[model samples]
Structure formats: C-alpha cells, structure tokens
Target: MVARDYGQYDGITQALELVGERWALLIVRDLLVGPRRYGELAAGLPRIPSNILAARLKELQAAGVIRRAPRSRIVLYELTPYGRELEPVVLAFGAWGFKALGDPRAEQIITPDSMTISLRTAFRPQVAAELPATAYGARFGGDDLLIRVQGPELAVTRGDGPADLAFASGPGIHRLISGELTPEAAIDAGVVEVLDGPRILLTRFATTFHLAA
Candidate 1:
C-alpha cells in the first residue's frame, strides 16, 4: 500500500485510501466482468506499467477487495464479494463521466471491457422495455461480445455465441449507443456489418440503449 493515510474516521476517506490510487478503480472496472489473468488485465490496461499493475493487484488483494486463485496452472485475479459491492459505484461513475466524453484522441483505444462496462452504465430500462427480447454478437478489436436484452434488462458478456444479430466494429457500436450515428448510417458507411440474423434486430439493438448527449 502507498504510505499516505486518509485517516480512520470518515468512510469516504477510508474508501479513497483503498481505491483512490491512479488506475486502481479502473482495475476494478475490468475485473467486474469476470476473473482475468495478469496478462489479460495488463492487456485491458494498456498504459499501466507492469510494476504498477503488480503493486495495485497486491494492494487490492491485501485490502480483501480481490483474491488470486490458480486456474489451469495460471493464477486468476477476481473480486471478492466485498469488492463486488462497488459495482454501483463504478457504474454511477461511468454514467456521470459519459456526458464529458468527446471524440477520442488519436492515441486513445477502446477495449472490450471498456465497451462492456459502458453498455452496463448506459442501459436505459424504460427504453429497453419497449424492445422484444434479443441478443447480439459483436466483434471488435478482435474481441467477441454477447449482448442480451430481455424486457427491461440488458447485459453484455465477453464471448461469441448464438445471437439474433451480429456486428463487427467498436466505434460503430459506440456511435450507435450514444445516438451519434443511426444504424442505417453505420451500415451505409460500412463501419458496421450485420454478419448474421435479421437487420431489424440491429435496429432494435441500436435504439434500446442510450447515453446522455
């Protein structure tokens, strides 16, 4: 742990002392989806130094926020139940931050975890309720994700499986969700392709979730 102490009294200060370190909450963000090996975490957080990543992992482990277990001869880091309690906190942060997001800089990149988390944070239950149950398979940045919407519930998982619709671009997905680009526009631009399933599902998928403009 870093040497700075925020004091033992206030809960907010204590919480920050545990997770306020740079890149720490982001590490938690990536892990919220599922367990990840060190390399996977490193890949998700492309900019974090290996040593810093190791240090953050150690700190989280010591705080009982995460735990390490052997998986197929490799160790996987996952959140403890106590750590999982921060889901709402992370999602709220994402929702609040969405309004500040402008176009990405040239050096910025999007990862699958980031995409998945955005979907979670921006889900609009009232809008989703109007759509029929559906699933979409999305492939972007060489990653496959399964997006499912059932009534008012929406979920995004990392994997490619049976889906009612499929798409293959990250920015296209982002644009669709943020209402920056319509589905038809994305298709016309050839930024997104429907590899399988009905085109209407793609339309519904685009309309089901939204972010604040």
Candidate 2:
C-alpha cells in the first residue's frame, strides 16, 4: 500500500488504498489470467513506467494481494487467494464499463489478457446452454485465442487448434457481439474474415458469445 492514507474506516476506502493506484488493477487483471514473469508483466502493460510497475508490485506484495513464487524454476507474480476474490468484482466492472465502450481510439490496442477478459465479460452462458459444442479460433491483430463452448461452459485459451471455425477480426467484432450486426452482415462487411471453417458455424459463434450495448 502507498504511504498516502484516506483516513476512512470503511471497506471501500481500505480496498482502494490497497489496490487503487493507477496501473495497479491492470496488474491484477493480467494475473487473473495466470502467473507472469516480470518481463511478461511489463510486456503486457507496455505503457506502464518501469518504476511505477516495480512500485505497484512491491505494494501489492506487501498488501497480500499478490506474491512472488517459483514456477518452473522461474519466479512469477501471482494473486493470492484474497486477491482472487476480486475476480467477480473485476468481471462486473468490465461488463459495466463495456456498456459505455464506444469505438476504439487510434492508439488503443488489445492485449491477449484484455481480450480474454472481454470475451469472458461478453459470454452469455444461458444462451450457450442450448447450443451444440463448438470451438472457435479467433485472431485479433497478432493475438490468437481458442474459444470452446460446451453447453454452458466456455473456455478461451491462447494458441492455435483444429477449431470448428477459425476467423480473423479486429475491433469490429464488437459489432457482432453488440448485436449491431448479424453474423452474415459482419462477414459481408469484412468485419470478420473466415480463415478456415464452416461459414455456418459463425452463426453458432454469434449465438454463443454476445453482449448487449
């Protein structure tokens, strides 16, 4: 925690003091995906100043929000159980913020971690519950994600695979998710390019993952 104190004896204030600094929550967000080396964290948050990153890491470690551990003989930063409790809060926050998310700014870029969270926030398990099992290969910029839907279960992992539908898209995929465009419209408008897969599966993909504007 930082030296600055809010002097409030409340849960929200205390929580903010622990992880309220700029770039602090983003660190936690990435860790929510998995443990990461110092270099990997820095790479994921390329805009964070090195000094600030180091300071936030130390503070989070001191606050019991995160800890350094050896993984495969290499040290990595991961969230503690207490920190993991913020997952639901983070998901809610993302979903709420997404409602106001407009078009992407020129400089805005999507990292794999951010994309993973986006998909999670947009996924509608209820709709997927009645759908057949399907897998989608999604690529945004250079990041690739394998999204699997089995009944109401959804998993998004990084890497390639023999997916039932493989498609490449940019920020415009948000249109499909927001219901602004149907699957066929997205394809015709070139918002999403079918890389390899049955075109019909794209409709299933739309049915599986979506978020209302």
Model 2 residue runs over 4 Å out of place are none
Tens-place lDDT per residue, model 1, 1-213, is 643496577888888888889989999999998899999999999999999999999999988899998888899999999999999999999988877777667677778998888888878888888877888899887889999999898788888988989878755456677778788887877768888987777678777777765
Find the 10 residues in a row with the least total lDDT in model 2: 1-10
List, in order, the clash count of every candidate structure.
Answer: 0, 0
Task: Output the number of the TM-score-best candidate.
Answer: 2
Model 1 lowest lDDT segment of ten: 1-10
- Clashing residue pairs found in predicted model 2: none
Q: What local lDDT score does residue 41 receive in model 1, on the 0 to 100 scale?
A: 98
Q: What TM-score against the true fold does each predicted structure earn? A: 0.88, 0.94
lDDT of 2 by residue, 1-213 (tens): 564589888999888998888999999999998889999999999999999999999999999999999877799999999999988888888888878878878788888898888788888899898888888999999989999888889888899887999999988788888888999999999989999988999888887777878
- Give the best candidate by lDDT: 2
lDDT of each: 0.85, 0.89
